[model samples]
Target: MTDHHDRPHHDLIEHPRPRFAPWLVEPMLRNKGTYLKVALAAAMINIFGLITSLFTMTVYDRVVPNNAFSSLIALSIGLAIVVVFDFVLRVLRAYFTDLAGADIDHDIGGRVFRRLVAIRLDQKKGSTGALTGMMRELETLRDFFASATMTALVDVPFIVITLIFIAILGGAVVWVPLAAIPIVVGAGWLTRPALDRLSARAMSEGLTKQSVLVETVGALEMVKTSGASRLLGQRWTRANQQHSDSSTRQRLVSTIATTVAASANTLAYAGTVVVGVFLIADHQLTTGALVACSILSGRAVQPLATIAALLSRLSATRTAYKQIDAMMETGSEEPRGTALKPARFDGRIELRGVAFRYPGAAEKTFDGLDLVIPAGQRVALLGKVGSGKSTIARLILGLYQPQEGLVMIDGTDIRQYDPHAMRSLIGTALQESVLLSGSVRENITLGRPGVDDAEMLRVAELTGTHGFMGRIANGYDLVLADRGEGLSGGQRQSISLSRALAGRPQLLVFDEPTSAMDQTTEMQLIDRLQTELQGRTFVLITHRPALVRLVDRIIVVEAGKIVQDGPRDAVLQSLQRPRTAA
Candidate 1:
């Protein structure tokens, strides 16, 4: 009977992300037919080994002892040859199977990484670590099975075929004992539902533990500051314990399956012996035939016993395959654009009644907004929080498309231009920016190749970063920490300016770029930007009203609509009058 509570628990747990595993399909299809050939070859190899063993029965069956020296020597050599060939066949099969399996894993990981890159930030926001686990560690287990480690699918049938050979040579009565095979198979079938559940739970708990550890490590500072170290430790312990419990349930099913098969083996062997003893009394069975049947039957039991265990493992691999498939099949957030490269600089932009709402959000962020900037014009964006300031920046960057109207650049709709191409046209120093782990030189000039050494030093000097960076141990060669954690906020911003300016873009955007710097540094940085970026357009989003002198125009937005728009002087006089806090 199904437990209703457990039913929903299993039903609710999802695979990392859904996509078809297209990468795995080609190699899998190539290796798909190899198993058939392997099975046939193995059966022939085993049959020879069986014939070698059966030859011993001829000695026992003969009335006069027929153990001549030459015959004994030849028989010994033949048996040795058969044993050696059997070992070689087994080893070769394992090697080829493992190779096939590794290829499948490679394909799965490749597809996982590629699909993850295309998934939208919102859809994949919650499963970073789980996605990593699915691509890397979890799929390793699946590799073993994809390689066809379920040799039983082939091996079991071979054993069945061997039984047919013996049953035909001997009497039809001998096959009565072989009926135990179905009994073992039946018991295994009964355990399938439980086994499937156990296997899926095993995978889920393992991935959960992996996700928790990764999350904990990422938030170690938060855990320390919040005094939740003990709580996190307990959570870690509990996760591992749950994983153990789930794995044990899987093992429990495996144990039952193995035991049932083993018991059936014993029953079949006993039945064969009992029937043979009676047949011997009736003079219906020869010692040679009886011995041959016993040997073949005994040899067959080992594989049948292992079948249940192999099937259980195969079930687990199937679960992992589905997870991999789900990620590969997911829809992409943006269609890839044909890459466009630039030859020169010209900056112009126009927005006509453009408006947008974020997916799943309750309200729109913009309503019929209209604006235009001629070549090389400097514009300032002023807005309170949630007034669609950041969203406007995203829309200009083509991170999101507007719902109502068009955004054009140089008289053409921006969407028709390549997204990657637009990134090169704009040089941006962001408020909450990240510096990748590498030398200072590598961090700067990140946008453009063929950056001259002189140009790097010039950009750094222009941004006021040269003063501090020169004092560091190795100057510009000093490697930043991951995310630039070792650097101060102001220093990071300066470096960001150097990196952005290195591109020599037609348009410059500073999203609160000077917010971290002191008044003296901010003044110098803004002056340098004004001089070096003389012909470039600018979108300066800042809280410092003192810096308003650098821009030609100002627009203030409130509640997703433009409250004010005019020359910088006019807007400033209006804003200076003052108002109460929200």
Candidate 2:
């Protein structure tokens, strides 16, 4: 189950504020107070760590040499008190760190998802599987900030203070751990480029594998019918193998760095002891000081080693951050500033000198195309495939913006109005109808709280949905599987058509809406819509001749140009006239 806080409220998307920082950075910065508290706890905890070393030194030098049991007991009691306080501080540090991370998670995760939904369709990049993989990277980023990795990072600065203490107490021996610091840091640094490269390769392969898996599952029936399993399976196998190899190499490099750091820590401790013993022989250092020096040397380099071990995680996090950041930076569909929220549009659509081509297309779908759709005008766009008939519907619906001209609703530029508000007034059912996993009523109403049972059934009856829905045991309550599984293509179209009418929209645009229905159902739907579309602006794009009954005007398009425009009967008569070769 998802947490309530992770869901972005509707108002957040409807009224977004200007972003000052990267989407993830702002949330972490917002919880700076908690991070500050965690920092303070870390400082106190590191300071308390010195107590153990000091106590050991005092026991060996003062208590043992002087045979003072009373002094030892007092030192032991003081050490116990410090230990208790230190434990509490460590626990508090962990709690504060987690609290800050949770706050960031709640804010940034929801905002990222919101951005994904609001981003312009033209700005979308990558396949569905790749996008999903990128989204999952959020968890890796959150874990980096919230886990023990951050704690290790915070402890690094304290290594300097530890070195200072060692220098003061075990003179000449402090140089040993200090010399090892550069070696440990350098080893980890040297492997970074390799680790980063491997991480990126692994991430890419993982995304590809995910894409193949999603595609296979989404179109399993088609894949089986078309004998594509062997091809897709080979692609999946290749991606998986490549990902595994890259991951293994990445881990190996990271392990080598960690192993070097660990070895340096041990060598630093041993080198300190070996040097301290010589000083002891020369009466320059005491046994107690030597022991204390060894303990402090280990503590100093331990953070460095932990940091080395975390290098791979850091690399992966960086890769994830770059991808997610790019996704969040895409252009959003929401208009800037306080956009007009008109209660309704008069349903007048116009495209003036419009030019457009899809992303990565070789030719323009429209060039200097000018057309106007009057309020309550029922028009049919007649064209063969690839003749830009459906493109006209999409442009009017504001699904895609023309590069060179304006799409106006009610004589006002569509860009000036809130996209949600403008689109709400236009009922759209595309060529491919998609139904989510939900009950029939839920799909019809689409979670609109204001829609009642009467409005739902009325639309269902008009769209001929009642004919098939009545046979289902659950009727309007029937639950659908993913993409309306277990239902025929015609049934899905009926449900989709019903949803379009459920809104009582001012404008209706459908492309091949009845392509999947039988002749009887198609005629019945056309009859019902002929009456239902009384005052609505209707734009129909279809190849079927029977649907002509719903429109009063006919416009024929060829190669992005309007070849003919007139009353329905005249256009039909012109089309039927025999043409002589010139």
The residue-by-residue lDDT of candidate 2 on 10-92, one tens digit each, is 11111122443467778878888888888888888888888789888889899998999999989989999999999899899
Please provide TM-scores, in order, for all candidate models, with all chains considered together: 0.81, 0.92
Query: What TM-score would candidate 1 get against the native?
Result: 0.81
Candidate 2 deviant stretches above 4 angstroms: 1-21, 66-73, 579-582
Pairs in steric clash, model 2: none
Give the Cα RMSD of candidate 2.
Answer: 6.0
What number of clashing residue pairs does each candidate have, in the order they appear? 9, 0
lDDT of 1 by residue, 271-339 (tens): 776777788788988766676776666656657777776767766766676665655555554445754
Residue 157 of model 2: what lDDT? 97
Best by lDDT: 2
List pairs with backbone clashes in candidate 1: 18-326, 19-325, 19-326, 19-327, 19-328, 19-329, 19-330, 20-328, 20-329
